[model samples]
Target: MIRPATREEYPHLVDIWLRASRQAHPFIDEACWRARADDMALRRLPACEVQVLEAGRRVIGFYAMHDDHLEALFVDPEVQSFGHGSGLMAHAMTGHSSITLWVYSRNVRAVSFYRRLGFSIVDEREDPETGEPESLMAWSR
Candidate 1:
């Protein structure tokens, strides 16, 4: 089940984000993700429309969106590869004619996953915060 995230669930969502971010972005320093956890919980997540994917009573995945831009999509590392990510993506796409997101160019798995979901690479640039090359991808209904 996917639903709007409650304020009480912010910590849990942050945990999922940290774990998944570390796993999927091995090329980046783990410390970077750790340093961003508090901001994710206190600022970033709240700034977006966040949704959580629950399995039974546990949150297994989530996506954060602002307008038509997808800011984040994460699945708990232990529960990944079981279609949770795709499910979250599908849910995020509903009611929007188009969506856009940025992904680290070195994160091949995520790049391929977005491609499979029909997102085309529209731009490429360096992320100033992380100094990492990233791609801008877009999908339209």
Candidate 2:
């Protein structure tokens, strides 16, 4: 099931974000993700509209959106490659005619996934925080 995330699930969401980040963005230092955990829970996740995918009462994935932009999408490493990410993306797209997101260029898997979902790379630039090349992607009806 997918629903709006409750405050009580922030910790679990952060755990999924951290684990998935580590797996998806191996080029970035793990410490970077660890240091951002608190910010994710306290600031980022709360600042966005977050929806979680639950399985058997446990959160397995989530997506965060701010207006028409998709800020984050993550699935627990243990439960990845099982369509959770696609499910979250589909849910995120339900009420919007268009959506935008930024993704690290080196994360080829993610870029490909978004492309398969109809998001096209509209721009490319460096991520200020990590100095990594990133692509700006968008999808529209």
lDDT, model 1? 0.93
- CA lDDT of every candidate: 0.93, 0.95
In model 2, the runs with Cα more than 4 Å from the true position are: none
lDDT of 2 at 139: 99
Worst 10 residues of 2 by lDDT: 87-96
- Model 2 Cα lDDT, one tens digit per residue, 2-81: 99999999999999999999999999999999999999999999999999999999889999999999999999999889
Q: Model 1, which residues run further than 4 Å from truth?
A: none
User: In lDDT terms, which candidate is top?
Assistant: 2
C-alpha positional error of residue 78 in candidate 1 after TM-score superposition, expressed in Å: 0.6
Candidate 1 residues 75-113, lDDT tens each? 889988999999999998885899999999999999999
Which pairs clash (backbone N, Cα, C closer than 3 Å) in model 2? none
Q: Number of clashing residue pairs in every model?
A: 0, 0
